[model samples]
Target: MDALPFALLLCGVFLFAGAVKGLLGLGLPTVAMGLLGLAMPPVQAAALLLVPSLVTNVWQLLAGPRFGALLARLWPMMLGIVAGTLTGSGIIAGAAARNASVALGIALALYGLVGLLKPQLRVPPSVEPWAGPLVGAVTGLVTGATGVFVIPAVPYLGSLDLDRNDLVQALGLSFTVSTLALAVGLALHGALPLAASGASLLAVLPALLGMWFGGWLRLRVRPETFRRGFFVGLLLLGGDLARRGLA
Candidate 1:
């Protein structure tokens, strides 16, 4: 209720977030939550990102059979994310959370750029099995504290030589599971209330709409072009986070 006005502001944020995610296959929460966190409480901003995160990915996961393959391949990462979410959500709070948010904003920005530029930096598919849990834990801790993490994870995944789209599909699928579980865990702990939940849902519209556009745009972009553009956005985001932190 209190953040209603700001929540409405997130409508615009979600639009950009969606567009980027649609185009890049990730970065929704990093874009939306990073910007919003700068302007509001990190927890509230994260809570707001919750609904948008889920709805957008539901479609992404449905983009093709790749999502199915990703789920099984990256199972360990999923476990790490879940475990990290539980632990971080339980332990971190207040100013530390805020600090993490600021740090993460910079990380998100930089991470986005890195992943975008190196979309084809790949490893064997077998790597994903172990990667799943490792990145999951790392992302879980970062996201739990700051409510974002996949920025780093994406680049890590991109370092592998798999299909760029498929790499994205894998991250999106695992992230979808991890973030949703994060919201549920937070809500159950009474960290996110109905107002937060409802507002998060409303924020989803622009993001969802944006993703649709991104999907359309993805068809037109050369894989390398997409990677470069995505990384440029990442650099900007990193600078933004740094500014927020220093300010």
Candidate 2:
């Protein structure tokens, strides 16, 4: 791919990703990585997602009022994410980097299946102290390996029974930290070059535009409907990723 064409493709991808996040309050990085991984190596794709993911998710995290409470509750998990990312960054940038696309495919497929199932698992408050960090560590490892961060994190957060806004903000907080951690990991591994960083920064513009559009559409559409459609698309994309990886 020529530089201009690649940048254009990235703009389109981020625009769609931002729209998804704007409407649902999550999934920007997941969508970006999944789509971009189709054309590039997963590590490079992950690197490109850093700037837009961080910027948008920071907006999502702070736009709400429950930041203090969520942070208080989630600090341990956030700590674990950082630790896991630092620990696993080497694998992600080295041997595992080659297989990252396949891993991402598996992660996406699992995420879609779980979303479709919509199981209601309750987490006891007593278990959270232990479970939070465990889940965060695992999610961080997955993010390190595949550039997809949802996995157990989304379901675990849902298990907490937060209000809609709180859930959104919580996801934003988790993803913001994940993005920062990923950036550091990639930087340490020398995977983030100046050109990619510049392109990622430029991508912020289209992503924001798409977010605005999606936010507008969110008011008119049933979110559940859109969510179902989103997952279905993910399932198909996951299948494609797996196929390409196997080829």
In order of appearance, the predictions have TM-scores of 0.82, 0.97
Model 2, runs deviating above 4 Å: none
> How does model 2 fare in lDDT?
0.89
Off by over 4 Å in 1: 1-8, 66-68, 90-97, 116-120, 124-131, 216-230
State in Å the error of residue 135, model 2: 0.4
The local distance difference test score of model 1 is: 0.72
* Candidate 2, pairs of clashing residues: none
- The clash count of every prediction, one per candidate, is 17, 0
lDDT of 1 by residue, 1-247 (tens): 3557775677888998888887767778877776786677677777888888887776666766677666766677778877887777653344455465566666666676666545555556666677757777887877777677574566676665658678657766766876786786677557888988887877777887888888788888765676676667667766776676667
Total clashes for model 2: 0
Model 2: lowest-lDDT 10 consecutive positions: 89-98
Each candidate: what lDDT?
0.72, 0.89
